[model samples]
Target: MAAGLAVTLATMTMGACSGERSEFDTRNESFLNDASPDAPAPGPGCGHQCSLDGRSVINTCTGETVQTCAADLACGAGVCQPPCAAAAADKSSNGCDFYFQEPRFEYTTISQSCYAAYVVNTSMQPVEVSMELEGKPLDLSRALYRAEPGSAEMTPLVGPIPPGESAILFISDKSPDTPLTPLESAYLGCPEGVVPASYVGGTPWGTGYGVAFHLTTNAPVSLAAVFPFGGASSAYSSATLLLPVPTWAKQHMIVNAWEMFRDGFGPGAQIFAAEDDTEVTIVPSRPIQSGKGVTGAPARVPVTYHLDKGQLLQIAQNEELTGSLVSSTKPTAIVGGHACANVPTHVTTCDVLAQQIPALEQWGHEYVGVGYAPRMGGEDELMMYRIIAARDGTRLDYDPALPAGAPVTMSAGEHVSFPAGVGEAFVVRTQDADHPIYLAAYMPGHGAAGGIWTGSDGRGDPDFVNVVPAGQYMSSYSFYADPTFADTSLVLVRAKTNGEFKDVSLECAGTLTDWKPVGTRGDYEFTRVILSRNYRPGDSFDGGGTCQYGLQRTKSDGPFTATIWGTAYCVSYGYTGGMALRKLVEIPLDVPH
Candidate 1:
């Protein structure tokens, strides 16, 4: 969940205006106006009447006072400012406030450009935005609308703008390909991260997407609103939205391999690949191949594309390898296209896949990790676990026995351990198994097991780790030289046949040192195996059917490796009895090439 958090992509800016004095809340509120009917006729020498904020005026002598008095004498003394004098003042000089309201659809032109309606309270007071559809909370978050080009910025309408000032509002239809989804609609409905915007009232709307802005402020600052005339969605591309970047914000160009190869290393590509933080300058090398059969020899190649960041044209040349050709052009983000090294000296490609439907909504990468547990019985059966965590901040603890319900809480710094009567169980013959089970003290979750020899079955210890032939009796125990130079095996002597019996391989090259077991059985209990060999981060081994995930050989003073003995089930059931011995193992991996 935290790993895939969404970030704000861009910001909007509102047009600038001069400030004017006003008497109002100056918060996110509006100014008010009132008129007196009992006022006497205009005093002598009064040519016209003007509102105190200086927006409209009425001519007293010319009889215009009777018609425009509503706007001229809203809330002050009859004499306030004379209308004739107010008209002489520049409209830009008068301060008017603007804020965003409903994003309702207005009329549209034949060209499909949209006109939208937005109400702003110029009354000099802040107002909370609320909406109800048929008396129910209206989820307008996914409401289809977009601001015209250059409408990406917003300014606060409460402070600083001169009184009687007017700002703009723009709205339209944009980003049709990526229609708003239910999840996004839900997110927008919450209003946790919504930013205010500003624009010129009555500004004409365009078709293509550019930047759209709103208004906001932590302190008092004068501002106005912008309501553009168009809001429409079209199949063809047009300049509907153009977002502006602030001087303090950081901008990045997401690039893909194909786009780099085909577009000839465009500005976005050069910036992503350039080293030393140096400016990029790319040029055309040779004509890039367009067909599937085309290939390039390893050498420095030149390419070109048109774009610039921070007012500078980006340019650079890249060294490419022959027979290792890749796509020329790619999207801003590629799902997966990287590779890592393997043991015995080899390479493997990894593809990042979408774990959920609708790839645009969810994306993730997968990597293999090894898991080792000695036995299962009593309370150990209910313990649920998963090798990988989900993007939703939840673990996929899978167990076959437990029913799915609320997540079971585990005590802090506590782990369940089997004291006696329980034995280690393992699924062999396969390397992939996912299931849920209940360990008496624990609940169920996701887990994987089994993938060794396809048809061969595996076994586990029913009573103890590495116990052999529980029913029959044996009389000898010994440690011999390893047959395999780098491998280790577990050997049992004078052991029982039916109770706990398993034939395990034991091989090592150096002195026996640092050996430990899980139970009181001493040498018979399940203990971790150690080997002396330096390993890199990603190094791994098949372990035949015996191990998986990341298996590493560590570097130590001696050549000998340690391992646990087998279980009685193995001697009776053979390989089908599963792994009789189990131990927690830590291996070092090799570095990626």
Candidate 2:
């Protein structure tokens, strides 16, 4: 995941040591007077050690302070500057006494081309045994073939440990059946040269954290794990991953997996799929920092494992034995827009509108403005407008009359409107590209002047009013009123794209006397809200006219726990701009407050 630079805290400014015998030496002198176990000389890679006021201060690789008092004081804020504890039953003595700390795991869904290779904190601590991938109910004693045609299982195998341990396991079709698919190995590919292998664990959750065998802190650590079997491969494989981190973690962490082959050939292959068979589990642990405090060590803790693959073949295989795919899955949604919108209705307030707009779901689709020939007055006629929907290098659908142009890719539910007279109103009757845009103009602005082009969904460009058309005075119109007037005739002109013009002339022949005000011509309008509490599956609401900020429900930290959700805004749209009005758009604050 991308992140801003982290500001490191200033190192504990080494204050002058108070000349008193440090805590460790002063208290242990009397016991040592009787002669017990002789303190072993610090190891070769041991960090800096100093005595501070009767305590042993050890500065680990990460600059963290570790204080050990001679069987008395507590380690406070990484330092041993304290009075010693006299009683033996005190938990304070046990607090920071551990000679070594375990590694921190940043649980993440398995990567597209990478299998689970947890970071092991080998520095300072003894790590002799490596981590292994274990499986549950469905025995993975041997590498299991994923139901996904040619994919093999990809699981982790732990090996002898040491400081700074990090490794990955490869399970191919030829390997014995284990729980996970070999999708990761297929993409990552086997190394060109010899690499050490290790033992595989067979626990269900073991697929992620895998079983880790701790090494003796005093011995030389080996770089590999014990793989029970070896073999060749007929097909490729990818690893499964967990969707998100554990609920308890505070910061948001993301796992990025890219393909790396023997020759560094091929572009990053398509890594995502929309089905359930490809779902992978992500296990979480503290972030791994090499040489840092024992945070990189693989943890042997219990974690929840729920099968959630999207690839259809894997889904079937998981279900054949694990029961229904739904039964084996967890109730968490993926992070992408489309994936977020697809989370089961039971778990979240899925954006029904976002689902309808492809652009909102993916970035590849864009809302691009095309050719725009400003009309001096009425030189241009027949303003052409069209919308094209494309995906995966293919035009799924498009407007037949729109000229060649760029596409206005927007979220599924996002709506854009062109000025009246830019072209005939094409209402978005449905999710079809051929559908005409919807238009709506209020009374007085009724008919052609009040005309609007919109979709059947009720979304459209602003209604055209006070059209100077051909021979009318300009002073009678408020450029702010009929803002589209300044839009001229063509804001966009292109072939095969969802492009539109900002300026255009409206087709209005009504006499001046017949004109009427479209409601109150003011920035302030009575803001009405529907479904403020319980909205139907696909329900939506919109606004237009002088209003810049449309009505929107307040967002919540989590789904369905909204104590209140309604129009909460600033002087401008969502509190950003500087515009203010005596009577601004407001909604019923009575959102069950």
Candidate 3:
């Protein structure tokens, strides 16, 4: 399966390079070191090899051979660059067709004040992003991630978002009681008038609500929604990467962090359709809420339903949805998360959790797992990681092994989890390409029961982020780190040899240095960097902000993936920095016969 796909990817990759690259088919066949072996070896000072493009050393650049550093150490820009240094080699999260679901919270709370945070325009050309409901576009959007609620600043998108930046648009304020006395502000987050009156979210459980965003760009871009409910202590805030349409699949298995919170947000899956009359079949691992046509179905039994374009089917249940199966007749968007959750369900506090389910084709056989930075206690905390198998008898081999009782194998719809200590990393590989699996990383709240929750003592609450596959690593990323987050830090992994060059760099922080290899693993290394402390809007800007998010850009010499995390005052948010969104398999959807 892997070899076949590689051939297909190579074929799809040939003509896609050069000129303004499209969002998909950006793959480039590596031509580095492909020059004839019969060619004479260069003389001294040939270490700094150069090329006209990124892959091959076969082209010419202004009377200079773009191969093996024949003469000069390096050539001019766009002339002879280093092998694999072309921006096209980056497998980034730039695509259209994204889905977002603001989990239900108290209608009159901060959670109701949701926004489409961090809509990154990763292209050179400006791009526009808009929200669509029930198949029609909504005239609402704004450019503020941490705006003062009720400031009336979160308005509909005004103009095109500049290239290589991010924008935050006010999604909606579900409170019907929003103030109206000549701009009278309700205690909720935003005024009712800010969002369309008809589009009411934060609805009661069992009332499936659907919302989608349509980006008007063929250029590569990425997006996420910030559900920062409440403020200060005990608040629940988390974010999810909005996988683009090209990555959407006909089948996906659910992976909720943990069981739901009693009388609070529970584990659930949100399904959205882009085409009308789409039939969705779901076999629950846990019983779904007995309504919305789910009244008679039980766990482990397939339940089918039909939905139209821009419609959503939210499956909420008292139990976690991990290990469940969802398959659709048409390409569909699926999100699985807990509105608020405690890792292990007994951690000190709970935080909202959401991550878009990558299509089966997006699942990878190899992964690198690393824990977040050390906590305030000075002890590198233990992070949690879960792997869900998409196929039966999927054997797993862990480099440096897992602590104690981590599973070495998983069956389809089965999930295995373990704790990762500070600096400890796990490089996981399955038996073969046929045994693909999904991985998710989670940071538990500061402590278990009896831990401090005060403003001055307690630090991070529970947070969640998807573990992108090594196959999907991108060479560059244009992402965001909300200034509202007190601690904005980055965690990333790359080839060990790549780290030896120390080429990773951030926009504001300059070049990244000191990469420690993962465990005793010789294949890869990982590192963490703090972007800002107690980030305040406008306090730290990249000198560009017209709906473009913080506009932070990070690049490397080779393919790598990073996770951006923010933690402070019992609230935290995390999401994959960016990815190439590579599809690995082609599954023929067999709609109910």
Candidate 4:
């Protein structure tokens, strides 16, 4: 299975490099030395090392010379390069071509009268960013600068951020004297003749409500939406790292469940329709906490609703909605998160958690399950994962090294999960290529009964994260850091026999260790490197201070997947979660025969 996919990827690599020079003369000596003798040589019918296109050097399967570089690059020095050093000076003209044009944030709520969003320039150059509110250009002045983490004061953003740096944009509600129009009121879900509760005087930002924003930047950048509660000292916050609109979005999704009943906080799914007049149908596997229900049999019951462009619907309920399926007439973006949850019931505090749900079309057959560290002063915790099948007859194969009892087969729309001991990771793959599945890892939400919470705490309120599949993996990626989190770590997974890390850079944080294997799952190995500010004291969150915010970049010689895990704790409330490093959206290297 791996061999077939590798060859297809090579063909794709060739297609991308098809426009280079047509002749492979000795002056390009680097090409000959780079070509592996074991790689397929040109077939008997071919006479030269370069394909007829003159771009590529040689084909791995047929041994024929082929173009493997993009048009703007030159096949030289054993790799794609610019014709001149000056031509390659700009990062955007090289391999950094993919970008998100319209990145959307779903839950921008006002806390203490102000809300904030962050933009990190992932490119090597400066970027000009603009904001859009309800389809209109928002005045840049409305956005004030919130200080980066570990800083003492706030300032306005008046210039382009240097490469690899970040800027915060704050939005505050307008005064009540400027009443909202009926149209504006409707958009905010406010009843007629009344101002939205969020905008009313003395209303706290944590009114169980939020607004949406659409951000546009001239260069590729990662975004984070943050809401803070309480005052300084016991300042608690909830944050969600946002994903830019990919080149393609799907119309179907299998919604993952948020752990229910952690301090009475329930799980919810927020669906955003990006297109106008989209008809959405939602089938719930369990009843919702909002007192909404369908009349038909449970398996056949579905609630249908229509959404205009940029509108969103959120469903929070008491029951687990793990198996719920959402479908729309057009493409849409969805997010799953807990409104406020404790890792375990009876814990000291609970906070918000959210992750953007990848579309079903992006789901793959294989995944490596991993989780966050146990709560402070607590023993290792058990991690749980849910596997959902997208098609009929999905047969699963787990790493035999894992503890027994993981399910081996699943039917269409079927979902199941099992627990693994702390720090233990495993791989799961479908037996065939036709049936794909989605996997989600749940971190232990509850802490030891006597430790954090006074009451009994077993599994804790597990924060759910969508595990990225190997098929959706990328050789390069960039992600934003949760500046407010006290601690953060980078998790890396690669095929044990096939890939190796290359050029891993943690912008502002220092690497605690080199790449080291944490576990083996079949042919894949999980490795991790701790990333924290230079001042982090040991592994404890208490001494890490506020995490410094910046963009992180990681690349590998072969395909690999990764995500960042973060934890924030205060005397009053605490939370933990993770998000995928955004893979540059480009033409997939895998080509189906």
Best by lDDT: 3
lDDT of 4 by residue, 1-593 (tens): 00000000000111211122232110100111111211233345433232212235554345554557565443332234442321122111112112111111112321232344556665445666666545666666535353554443456667776655666655433354675544232111211222211332221122122234556665555565544321122233344445554322544453635455432355666666666787777676665433223122244367676766655655655455655667777767776656454444333344445556666655666677765544443333555566787666676655434344466657766677655654666666665445667886655443432332333322223345567766555444555444444445566665442233344333333322344444342445555544443324223233342234344555544445666654443311112112222222222212111
Sort by TM-score, top down from the best: 3, 4, 2, 1
Q: Write the per-residue lDDT of candidate 3 for residues 350-467, one digit (tens) a residue.
A: 6666777777777777788887766654334566777788877776666665454566657888877666565567777776666788888887775621222222245566777888
The superposed Cα distance between candidate 4 and the true structure at residue 144, in angstroms, equals 5.2
**Regions of model 3 farther than 4 Å from truth:** 1-92, 105-111, 141-158, 175-199, 202-204, 207-215, 229-234, 263-265, 293-296, 377-379, 448-456, 496-502, 536-549, 586-593
Q: What TM-scores do the predictions have?
A: 0.16, 0.20, 0.75, 0.64
For candidate 1, the per-residue lDDT at 518 reads: 25
Task: State the displacement of the C-alpha of residue 341, model 1, in Å, after optimal TM-score superposition.
Answer: 33
Write down the TM-score for model 4.
0.64
RMSD of each: 33.1, 29.8, 11.8, 13.1
Worst lDDT run of 10 residues, candidate 4, spans 1-10
lDDT score at residue 257, model 2, on the 0-100 scale: 16
How well does model 4 score by local distance difference test?
0.45
The global C-alpha lDDT for each of the candidates, from Candidate 1 onward, is 0.19, 0.18, 0.58, 0.45
> Top model by TM-score, which number?
3
Report the candidate with higher lDDT, 1 versus 3: 3
